[model samples]
Target: MVSGSNGDGVRVPSASFSRLSATNVLFGWTWPQLAVGGVGLVLLVIGGAAGFNLPVMLVGVLVMAYGLVRFQGLSLLAWTYVWFTWRSRLREGSNVWSSSPLETGRTVGVLGVWSQVEDRAQVVEGESVDVVGTPWRDACYLYDPDKRQATAVLTLKVEEWSLSTNARKRDRAMALNNLTMTLASTPGVVELKETSLLMPTSAPVPPDLDDPDMPSWARGDLAELWAMPEIATPLANVSWVSVSVNVDRLSTRSRNMDRLTERNRVGVLLGDIVQNVVAPALVECGGQHGSIRWCSVDELRDMIRCVSDPAHASSQRKVRRGEPTLSYCEESADGEYVTLESCVARSWWVTQWPDRPVPAGWTRDILQGDRMIALTHIWRPLSMAESEKDLANKQSSMLQRSRLADQKRLSRDERRERREQAQREAEQDANWPDTDHQGYITLFAPDKSRLDDLERGLRMETGKYHLTLNGLTGQQRKALATVLPLGV
Candidate 1:
């Protein structure tokens, strides 16, 4: 819950997210569970017809139990399937990737990632306004060939909470709420990803002290002093929001056009959404004009590189066109962490957020510091119809579950609290559309030896904020992809 006000002002905003309902496909059972249970039932029927064979009936009961039993939130059967899938991927060497320059016609620079970057400028927009005269010239879109989706990035300049007054913080919080609503209502927008990274600054090279006018002894002493390690300081804060447009959703009306034309049309629609829809919402958050703008091609590439390889983020090397944002030459996923050419990384999913209300910008503590950590939050917005249907189903399910609990004579206090929280959620949904959100945080290290220490520190840091991080032990590769800001 969050609220802010100053003397006679309206309450800013407050939200309750105490519980999340897991809606299943049929009668609170997933498809896999239903299928398995059906087979078990058939077996029991056969046993009954065969004079109630004790062994057969026992086997059937066990099978049903397997389908119903859950381990770490997954049914026993589903858990077994996942384990086998992970092993298969590992045995097939699919979890390992190594780039070979000698291979002919092989796609480089983050293979199996997004497709080429394409310009969204059109002839009708006027050639003069289409082209940009900056280093990362012209607005471009990252196209995913597999999904046929286009993603556009916007660089955000958020206001500092510490520097703002109480009234300003209240306004900013409301603006953030408005931003969330805008994203949910925007047409053709499938996902919104906000990525923030902090890169550490390295010690500066000693100045050229070999002056002919200076004495030799003094020059030597000065050089020695400059060679000492420099104090650590904050480097840079890179934040960007990527908005992905669903091409298939927008292409329905333009069936007669060719593929290229359809893609261009979708791009034009995305450009308008960014400019007219997202830009204004961002302006409110920043408390200033022009707080958000479309990221240029070069800037996007740099942002990707910074998240990909933090050690070299401050390098003076120019980001070339069509060059891959990730600089690693090899990547191997292990049981606990992933080994890359330049760094070792481990990913964690945020399983819990703060259960109680806290001040705004509470997350600043995690993002700040010299640690090499990146936090990516992905939001999949639901349309009005979808939101209404989902909420209705969830509310009904909650009430039914509550009734069952009452019949079982379960803990009354817990059930009552959950029902009240569900009610608050329903009321909130009535005011705004619903969005599915997930967060992933990845910590990078120079080598495997330092990974454990970093993980310990990260876990402790997150514990302070009541945030829980569950390490993705065997799914390191997938977790890495999920945490990175490549619209994964």
Candidate 2:
């Protein structure tokens, strides 16, 4: 259920499951547009034949043109209609869609699915569910008021992670962890796709050029000159590389500043715009010389900060009547305070790894200085110090869980060893040669009834017993033949 009550209020609700309308997808436009066009065609052909004026005739032509467009099934709009028509049939009275409802809850919710004609597997068809982060992702919606944290971590019951020993499980874990956290915290997520590993698709990368003239200045350093198109080129290749993040894992570090009022959001809107959004444009601008460089997220933000004038000098100011002076003022940092560098190092830390290995000094600061951003990006909003704390907490918890699980497994192994030892001892006792070589004995029942009675009597005396063959002596075989009576 989408949570109803919480103080910060609803920013968004977790998908529980998101339903997508077929009409919203490609070819969904078919019937709706066709219906309009069909009526319009009737009007046009009728009006033209009925002696309407040139303007009316032009309107008729436009209507018929729309009908042909519907017939062509070329454009996105027409494609939607074609899809709808393909799914819809005149078999019965009701129109039907091609795909069935996907199980979202106890009662399945209908979200249309499709791939393509040649697609035998029917892969990558349906609504796109983008799993992204918040504050960093700017993806929150005002829906679920109570945002649950820590308790609600995203977990995929994956097949055993059969990663090679050299693979970086930690980085992969961290990346997935934070990606999950962001998507979980921001409840507006539609779907989650992993690619490159990309989820939801393995389609070819789309072209990023919105305009041929739009210069790109991505990568390089975070200086005034780094991202300007006047100096660099290749701005056309810029597309925001989405970072993965885990929200609940990071929420322990999420700071709830009473400072997030309407006024705060307004101020944050401009500054955050520069830091989070606008800085990328610089790198995307590329240089005039056709050089392309990637900027670490920090470098982009820092360079923007370097060029930007400070909002105000940190000064002691009078507090309002009810408000505490400490709330608005910057004080001497105590031992509890943390530095930004430490925070970034930890926040960016993922459980996954680099197969070969990158150097230890791979902070965004250092990467930015080197004018390189990682192929992957992670977004978190806390000050570097807070992010670091969250990272530490996540690691500590994971380690503890690992230890506990290991301990439990160790106990099981010990129990199994004991069982084997007991079995071995029992086997030795049974197989040990009787010191007295006790007299051998054999007994047989003459009939099935007698045999059942013997078996029952043995069960009464013994808990569990192993069966063995009686010695096949020639006399024993002759007696068995005689026991058959008439058959013998």
Candidate 3:
């Protein structure tokens, strides 16, 4: 990083970061500026040596300087990861001030077809581009004609990531269905008067890989690779805005295949074109060709949090005369993703209804455990085994409560009165003090080295008995705490 006293006073700094932490790092440099700067510097230096043109080398020195400037401060880099909250399908865009903001007079229109492009103007710089609803991450192509240097920021506001084959098929089928109806209703456009479906009669028999007469019993070896997902070559040209990628064959050999489900196979494509392509090309186009999109600092912060923990949301809010509030909560898993679902009402969500919004000052259910008390929090899907276990525990708890109810034969109103009366008595009892004192158990060790082994043995024993425990102090009491568990 360099700070020239004669140049603009923008701060320049540098530091190292892990490789994965460095991808979203946004910075800009024009190839022309760098190339010109390089040539000028070399010519000026050589000219100085050869005695021809000192100014050429000086100009080259100025142009040759380029850098990857960190967009937002790296300290807050943790929240910028937004694969959550925002789905992978939604478009994302952001407004980045270049060395200068775009003046108001400029007007720009963007088109998708590559034939219309006139010059090499990148969109992420100068003015903003795309519709207001277009997300930051979905910046396919942006256009800003104003020239004075500015930044074309890449915003990542991911939308949906449900890219499974079933999802795609359903999406395509829905589109097809809508098209069918639209064509039938309207007369002007091409018509889908009729429709039919077809299915493959049989799986393609793969070529035998070994000796022709190898027994069918041993033929399993030949079918191994043949059973892999087949790749289909691209059929038509897709003219996407800003980016033009020729789609190749779609292959299923990329990811997990063992746990494959119907209506889908794992993702197959020519990289993340539908989502990651497009708008980025606008930024790359530069000049009047590019467009810009930006969210407020506060919205960007919330967006970052949402993206980082898609499953959990960290919200920012302000009330009329109050300090801004930051609240957090986890999103419910999609029903289709409930792998270990149990047929019981013991689900955390089932027990604690979600239809109602959470009240203020009540974050226990949101951040902590959703159980009766939340001391520790874990965000993970409940597998069927765990769901089953929860069901059993809930039934047992219900049985205990049922027994208590049965023991007191009362109507609904009477039961309520009785429960209230019992609660009051329990409260009264809690207020009363008890005088029973606990005695300490002490084990005297002949050698200090032996105490470590004794403590370890006692700790293991306590765990076996499901005994409550805490750290022990005083050598005598500590020794006793460990030894007593062994006996119990």
List, residue by residue over 1-488, the lDDT tens digit for candidate 1: 44755465756444433433355764456788878887788888889989999788888888888776654434688668766877887788666664445642443442323222222211111123332221122666666666767777778766776787666666777776677777776667888887776655444655568668888888988877775533322366667788887777653454434544554566566776777777776676653465566665566666656555665565656456545555342335446777665678778877666655666667788886656777887878876677777766666666667676666765643574466556646656667766777788888777777778877777788887777676666777667766655555
What lDDT would each prediction earn against the true structure?
Answer: 0.64, 0.27, 0.26
**lDDT (tens digit, per residue) of candidate 3 on 1-488:** 11112124422221111111121211122344335445656766786787766576566454444222233222212213333222321232111101112412221212111111212222321124422223343232222233211112222222122332333323333332233232222211111111000101123455666767888766885566555532111111111111111112223445554564311221112123223432333232221233333323233233222222222221223121111111211111221100101100001111111122222112212211111111111111222343344334433544455677787666653454345334434433443211111212121122334434444554454344232332221121112111211110
Segments of candidate 1 deviating more than 4 angstroms:
4-18, 41-54, 71-78, 103-137, 201-234, 251-260, 287-293, 321-324, 327-333, 407-430
lDDT of 2 at 277: 34
Clashes of each: 0, 64, 61
Q: Which candidate, 2 or 3, has the higher TM-score?
A: 2
| Quality of model 2 by C-alpha lDDT | 0.27
> What local lDDT does model 1 show for residue 204?
62
Q: Global CA lDDT of candidate 1, please?
A: 0.64
Task: List where candidate 3 sits over 4 angstroms from the true fold.
Answer: 1-37, 49-54, 66-488
Error of 3 at 138 (Å): 24
Candidate number that wins on lDDT, 2 or 3? 2
Clashing pairs in 1: none
Window of ten residues with lowest summed lDDT in model 3: 337-346
